[model samples]
Target: MNLTPESKVLIQGFCEFISGTHVAQMQAYGTNLVAGVNPGCGGQELHGLPVFDLVEEVIEQFGVIDTTIICVDPYDVLDAALEAIASHISQIIIITAGVPPLDMVQLLRKAEACETLVIGPNSPGIIVPGKILLGTQPSEFYTPGVVGIVSRSSTLTYEVAYELTKAGLGQSISVSIGSDAIVGSSFLQWLQILDEDETTEAIVLVGQPGGGSEEAAARYIAEAIDKPVIAYIAGRQAPPGKSWRQTGTLATVIGRDPNFGTAQSKLAALKEAEVPVAERPSQIPELLRKEIKIN
Candidate 1:
């Protein structure tokens, strides 16, 4: 929470030649990248940050790593995250996509056991504009404000943030909390965080068809959340019992298909809970203005 210009960050899979431009970009944007981890690539530097062969080596050198961003391959994501956790890294943000669900499940279990917060295996990551960049979220699409945005889709999180920023309804934090069915965290967790965040005056939830997360969020909003929750569940037109790029079909595939997470069912739950639902991303700002009297 105490994000500073010098917050210590360690890149788990920092490459020298291939990823120099990216690490430099992050450094340019005020990301305090202290070190990187790449087996057999130690004693080297990328973007001026030292590279370590393992997370333990980085820990031994740097003392304490505040946050670690996992950039390893999907198959290696679990091991990378585990290494980070072993090094007592409190917060991990996994940017690697396409990690097997079972692997994520195992990783999440381990993370939970250690009381660590893991952001994503398939996520764009979290960004608080003018403050911290935990993942790869573009800062141009973000603006610091009272609205808190949480979403499942990586692309749509940016689209919604762009819409809000354009409308002058800047966001406190915009994050893609992983779109895979068996993700580390859920809307409920972020909802609670945003609820407690004093800067957040309103909440924007961008959910997609296929997971019970939306339905669960609605239930929580109805019961606990006091802030005005503007909701948008994407993929309404997605064909049922079919795939829509890992979004819509997760419920059935994961064998946790709540009758409520389907397109129609999800929308109904939100409406039933009196959460204002937007039909499209562009409509979100208008809905926010109407609901929270913003911009």
Candidate 2:
């Protein structure tokens, strides 16, 4: 779970207000802002960071970028993603803004062909505590520790990490894999990394009502992982035909066989498989304490 320092991150859509805020937040977290791309804001300064009109110009000046954070509108997301893949400047690319699923499907196809690790077209980005902060989350809420957290909801990820810190349990890694249906990566992918991380003693998975991803992970945990897992599946009893906050939740509800009963059934599957499922958010800390002996 150690985050090695890399050269710089090339950020997309520097002209937006939220993008500017995200840059400042990352700077506070100690990440060097190397370059930015905005088609209209070329040659201007954004919060003291140089802005370029295009990705090519930014890459030409900055050399290789370790990461790229996309903060543009959904309409522009696919083009930005293609540019990121073509540039080959970063090992990781994070898309913080929400994009259409149809666009994401095309983006994912390109990403797989390019072999690039894309995180979120609708996410909070990844935080490798004490090393780099590449998303919209507050830096003060994170610390370097031995627990790895992976969640679908950005807000819930923040709350879970906050609670862990309050209980004196810091985190080694915290990832919000976005709430979008066709977004990059999955809970299992992050869980694989955490399972092998020597610094991680336990895992905290925050899932919402939707998808069998949690159930799949629970089966993995039951068979493969030895470390304790503490889970909280949100919106279990959410009424049918209503969408929850997470986009993935809504998609899972809409596209499944029974059409909308997947969430509660997924929770039941996890519990049946012996995964410690918290019925409520408040029960998470206490359950985790008992399972991991963190007291």
Candidate 3:
């Protein structure tokens, strides 16, 4: 949600091997990580931060935590997230990969009912370049600036940010909405946030071939977003099954579903919406610059 330098953060299922460096890096980057949640490890210290047995304990001791970064075992992600939501943490970022889709479905229902914002089951989370890091986004690629970047591909998110930074276009915020098939957030959700954000001047949407998300984003941008927007859809040349890693998208490989989740359709939708589409990550800066100038 409204992440800032002062946002108090906690980690769910905190593990030294999985989350140690990230914790240290977040602290170094100025993120206000107040505590962590790892059952049976309560009262223990890792990375010089307090670890709690439960999300409620962390809340009771630290007061309101703004975000919780979940890095538990794949199967444990659901319980970890439910605990965070129950604790009333506004933002939940799930970093564990390979979470069963059913678990995500359940988490989404609870999150929506509680008005909670979940980032990913397989995500890099959100970063406010030079301000705070909520997940494991590499800090080397980002800088403080006006553009807001949102992507389904974590690797592409980094490459795009590096390109933007290289072109002297730093980012106001960068969000990896998770590469999983059933993520908590969507392109339209973050698009609306960026459009209304005072610090964000433009938006870069990095999409993949699978799913109708890119097409949905195009429709939303056409009607709702006032700020300039540019897009780069990966997997244009990727064969059906190889296009995306998500299970649902992988089905396209066998079904050859031409009407859905095709890169051609995504590009057509974005083009029809008048959104500039970059052929490559390096071209994003140039297209974004053109969009900003025109708007």
Best by TM-score: 3
CA RMSD per model (angstroms)? 2.5, 2.6, 2.2
Worst-scoring 10-residue span by lDDT in model 2: 245-254
**lDDT (Cα, tens digit) per residue for candidate 1, span 146-242:** 9999988888888999998888888888878987657787899989999998889999998887657788898999999989999888888877665
Candidate 3 lDDT, tens digit per residue, 150-186?
9998889999999999999989999999877788989
Ranking by lDDT: 3, 1, 2
Q: lDDT per model, in order?
A: 0.81, 0.76, 0.86
TM-score, structure 2 vs. true: 0.89
Per-candidate clash tally: 0, 1, 0
Q: Give the TM-score of candidate 1.
A: 0.92
Which numbered prediction scores highest in lDDT against the true structure? 3
Stretches of candidate 2 off by over 4 Å are 15-19, 90-97, 248-261, 293-295
lDDT-superior candidate, 1 or 2:
1
Lowest lDDT block of 10, candidate 1: 248-257
